[model samples]
Each structure stands twice: as C-alpha cells, then as structure tokens.
Target: MLGPETLSTPPQSPLVPVLPAYIPPDVDMDVVLAEVAADGVSAAPADESGLQRVVADAQQQGIDLKVVVIDTNPPIDTPLRDIATVVAQSHPDATVLVLSPSFAGTHSQVFDRVTLEAGEDLAKTGNPVQSAQNFVDQLNTPDFPWTGLTIVLTVGVLLAAVLTRMLQVRAKSADAPKPQADTASADS
Candidate 1:
C-alpha cells in the first residue's frame, strides 16, 4: 500500500510493468549498452565466445545486430520483448535481440516486425549462442511463395472439376437415344 509519495523511485505500471521507457530500472541499461557498444553483444547470459564471434561476423556482414541475453526476467512480470523495446529506444537503428530463460524478444530498425517475430521464434534454443546462430541462419533462408502456390493449386483443382463435369455432360448426351417419331403410329 505504498502511495506515490512514499515511493522513493518512479512508480512501475501494473499493466505495462516496465520502467518509465527512458530506461528500465530492473536491468542495468548502462552495462547492456556498454557491452553492445563494445562488440555488438552483451556479456551476461552468454559468456561463450562463440556468441560474440557470431555477432561480430553478423556485424561484418552489415547486419548491424546487437544481442542481449538476460539470465532472468525483470523484477516484475516484464516480457523479454519489453526489454528489447527499451534497448531499441536507445538504439533505434540497430537490431536488438534479447533472450530469456524460456523466451526470445527482439526489436529492430533494419528489419520488419514480421522478420523480428520470426527471428524470435527461431531464437528460442535457450542457449544464447545457438539462439543467435539460428536467428542469423534464418536471415539467409529465402521465403517460399506459399500464396502463389496456393493460387495455382486452387485453379488446377477447379479446372479439373470443370473438365470432369463437361465430359460427364457430353457422355450423357451421346448415350441418349434418338426418338423414332410417328412412323410407328402411321404404320398402326
């Protein structure tokens, strides 16, 4: 029941549950930024030199990638994505990847939201370096045109149905017997 007056620091939002957006209090923004500024990858959660190597290679390839691996979530129920967003505010132009124990989150200026979400899906290996490797690998994979393939398949099925219907009609008409008119009546 701490009121605003009683709070020594800025109050956290129950809904957003994040810091005031300038910087998140639970996370050491200075350390994250400093590590990223040094070699494009943070030092925590990924002490393995392989993640740093992967990030360095990505940077060399013009990816402008920065990775942050948080060993734990914030003090509140903050999403890893929110942390990534906070990092993004500091560097809007660089792609930031933030990994947690069970989830991945990212924010990027060089990539679209779809790609970022896809990267997050690929980056949930629970190992920071593996997550980063999977994300980078996904970038090189070409997109298959599922929409176009679906359209083609639909049209083919419709065409086949129409051809079958037309052939059935033709066969029925050919098998139909011609009427022998009034000749029998005249003979009678």
Candidate 2:
C-alpha cells in the first residue's frame, strides 16, 4: 500500500507535444481522457479536427471508438498499449487507439486482443490523422469468424464418425446367425 509519503503531486507530462522529443511516461492520461470525453479525439490541435470527424462518424454509426494520438506512454519504460488501457478505464466498451510517432497501442471492449493487434497491423502509422482514419475503416471491416466456423466443422465430423460406428455395429449384429429353435429340447 502506498502511503501519503509516497504520494507526490508531480505534474504529468503534457499530452500534446510541442515536438515529438518526448516519449512514453510523459503521457498525462487525465488530459487524454478529458479530451476524448469532450471531443472523442485527443491529438494535436490541427490533427484533432479531422480525427474527431472520423471518430464522430464512427460513433454515429453505433461504433463506440475513442482515439488518443498523444506523443506519449507509461511511467516505466512506456508501452503504447498501456496508454490505450488508461483510456479504456474511462470507456470500457469503447475501442481505443493510442498512436505515437513510432508505436501504436490499442484496446477494445468489443475486439479481442488478437483482433486489436490485427487492426494495428494494417492501420496507418506516423501520421495520426491517417492512422485514426485507417482504424475507423478497419473497425468497419467485419472479421470472418473463422474460429466459430472451425468449431462447427469439427463437431460435424465427430457426429458423423459416431453415427457411422453405430450403423456398422447394427449391421454386424443383423448379419450374425441367429440360433435355431430348440425343437429337440421342446419335444423332450
């Protein structure tokens, strides 16, 4: 447990970077969350406008997505995913995209971790606006439920095998000779 002695009021690094010189740990999540709550987008002054447009459109389409393109990361060896997590705390059901100059972190209540990674795999990088736009498009693209299909196919195969074995057993019993009536015993 952290005591008041450990609590310090040091200011968090600013979310907007005058220059990309600042890296992870410099991210102020409060500002990010506040901006996202207010505008659905938190980025440079110029980039936020376009990004907000895309995010708003997505929201109107019933897509709960919040984008935070800060020039920052975690307090310890910042990872971009952590940034997304901080935002996710506020909007647990929303998909979040946290973009840095060189890294992208993401979290989604609707998407699995692999799906989030897959989205980042094809999403634009470096340019925040473009990246956010690409992410919107990615969200709109439906992922084929390969896992579900595979499960159904596997179940079908197992059922077929069981049915085949049962039929084989029934046929074998039918083909076997039946004992003749014991007429001698009955006469005796």
- In order, the Cα lDDT scores of the candidates are 0.76, 0.77
TM-score of each: 0.73, 0.62
> How displaced is residue 146 in candidate 1, in Å?
0.9
TM-score of 2: 0.62
* lDDT value, residue 15 of candidate 1: 59
Model 2 stretches with alpha carbons more than 4 Å out: 1-23, 72-78, 147-188
Model 1 worst lDDT window (10 residues): 17-26
Cα lDDT, model 2, residue 89: 86
Per-residue alpha-carbon lDDT of candidate 2 for residues 1-188, written as tens digits (9 for 90 to 100): 96566656978676754342333556677788899899788888989888888888888888888888866434432356676777888889999888877667788888777777776865647788888777777777888999999999999999999999999999999999998999999999
Angstrom error of the Cα, residue 141, model 1: value is 1.5
Model 2: pairs clashing at backbone N, Cα or C within 3 Å: 25-73
Q: What is the C-alpha RMSD of each candidate to the true structure, in Å?
A: 7.2, 9.2
